[model samples]
Target: MRPIAILSVLAGLSALTSPAASAQDRPPRPPAFASPEVTAEKKVSFRIHAPKAEKVQLSSSDLPDAGRGLDMTKSDEGVWEATVGPVVPGAYRYSFNVDGLAVIDPRNPATSEANNNTFSLVYVPGSETSDAKDVPHGAVAEVVYPSQTLQRPRRMHVYTPPGYEKGEGRFPVFYLLHGATDSDASWSTIGRAGFILDNLIAAGKARPMIVVMPAGHTGPFRFGGAGGVSFETQMAQFEQDFVKDLKPYIETNYRVIADREHRAIAGLSMGGAQTLNVAFGHLDEYGAVGVFSSGVFGITGGPNGGAPDTRWEDAHKSTLDDAELKKGLRLVWFGCGKDDFLLKTSQATVEMLKRHQIDVVSRDTVGGHTWLNWRDYLVEFAPLLFQGK
Candidate 1:
């Protein structure tokens, strides 16, 4: 070999044998973290390999100390970890906050999507409501339909009960609504409505019905709007779309009884307010109504403005007499957690309905305004629907 080529080859060999190059050529080391591990006892142990993080904590939805950050301790390996409860059987959303920044669990793939935030999900099996049992499952579909009322396209989720494909018979329909910030998918994903209904129906505790979950927002209207448009306007548009567009679509496409006796409307939080407004206004349309963790803020206004055309209270009172209402209305169910912020409003609304000669079925559970309470409410409310029809 030439002298220059010999020197170049020696340099190349020296570089290849260097410690940094040898380290780079070696296979990467596996992660040392074991996170979000569910133990046999149902306790969830979470860990994050953030050696340089100043602090780390875990926040969860509806768990014992939900919304409050549970402090995580650091190990000698520089990993932070915390073991949460023998958690109840359910699907839960959670995230890790490291040095004031929120992030999803890198180790867990199960997640929930919301308008504002995405969270990691963990399911603990055992509870009757959340667990997947050895029973037939219902089908859930994402449906998009034109909205003449809103002058745009809208999306909804429809849940058909098991054995619906066989075309056994026309079923009752439940219009389930989500809260202010949630979308139509909230019920099926995080709320576990499908599982709850399946379990209930299989046990013969509740009647099988088609569940229609529609988007609560209508155009520019939203919860607590600050611009010239009021929140009521948005609600009115939603009610219009629900009554005119959504109802017609369901009746035309699905085998549902299109009358008051077999129709029901129910919601949570803001949706509960919408339920009171829509169901009460259309007594001839919906026989049953379930309101969870919310109530009419006042009697003077409703989804529509105070105009005679849009006032739910006025319409409800004017459309039917006491005897007619008593005969037509089947269920007026009200549910709220004992510690819910809306407890007073719910109780007051129940009293108001009773004063108006409406029989209200009231239920107070032990939790706050979380999916836990909403799931319980649905379990109780679904059985009461379409009965004696």
Candidate 2:
């Protein structure tokens, strides 16, 4: 057997040699590092155990391949391991691809859930001491509001700007949306919007404001359910939910600028399309709109068709062609990663908007269709959401 295997077996035997040996008497396990270390030179190691699987790979947003990952060498006990090169200190989320299935580390508790795959999060030390409390922090709260449109109680997330608890000032509001595969918690948990915005505000780079992240999944033309709906009908239901139900709840519960100029909507992926549909269709309600890596312009067919039809003509009729969106909208922002599959469609939308004499702030970044890109966009977009309007 290999030297490492021999050492492992010997270590295991050592624990069994003593009748009084407890779980704590065994050798301490290796440190499981996920995020990059903060020093100039840093190394990250990841491991997973799937003995029955023939192949396994480690994937991460900071690395490549949608975090789908690197191959792991199996041990006699069925554990697999891989190490990453030196990286800058920051927080990162990762997962393991076991036989083409993404899985989180069973040992780690810091996780984010959007689907079947839970993420493993790591916080690396940075320029400051790892536990320094120098930075001012904000708080997050998940809220539920009565939805008259859907006839149910809908939940959402709210991020109160730092110093909000000490002041009586009413803040402007930004309604941010998440993609199809995500829920309301994506902005605060996975995207880290609260932290990013708090940093920006503390640095005087951004003004204090309220950000409301609503659940944007709307089912078919049906009234009560919010799932398994056609793309077109889903968009319509989202509009009703936002304008009729969500807006009133925010205006009543939170201290906000309850008018058009103070309201903005932005989202990524399917949520991006929803942003366009909600803000543009109800131009009288929101003065600013943002669509990030959105696949809105191409798609057709109803629920009868496959889930993600790319025929734009059929899915986006009323909202996409509205003239008021161009006339009344104060700021329209569009962003996408240069390497994203939806780049062409984003560019095409910019051209169409320009042809209609509607100006927009178009941005491109170095990323694909991952949350890393979305997190970066949140860092850049939050300050600009309700500023000029």
- What is the per-residue lDDT of model 1 for residues 56-167, given as tens digits with 9 covering 90 to 100? 9999857666478989998877788988889777888889999999999988887876644688878888887657788998998999999998788899999999999998
Among all windows of ten consecutive residues in candidate 2, which has the lowest summed lDDT?
A: 124-133
Model 2 agreement with the true structure over 1-389: per-residue lDDT tens digits: 99999999998998787556765586555444333223345566666756689988877766533354677777776768776756544456778778887778776787765532357776554522122245787677889888888888888899998778886889989888998656787777767777777777777767788999898765422233344566566677877998898988889888999888888889998788888777656677887888899845464223355444444434445555677645567888888999987887677777666655678889988877877678677777777766653
TM-score of every candidate relative to the true structure: 0.84, 0.76
Local distance difference test, per candidate?
0.83, 0.72
State each model's C-alpha RMSD to the native: 5.1, 9.3
Residue 188 accuracy (lDDT) in model 1: 86
**Candidate with maximal TM-score:** 1
TM-score of 2: 0.76
* Superposed model 1: Cα runs more than 4 Å off: 1-34, 219-233, 298-316, 319-322
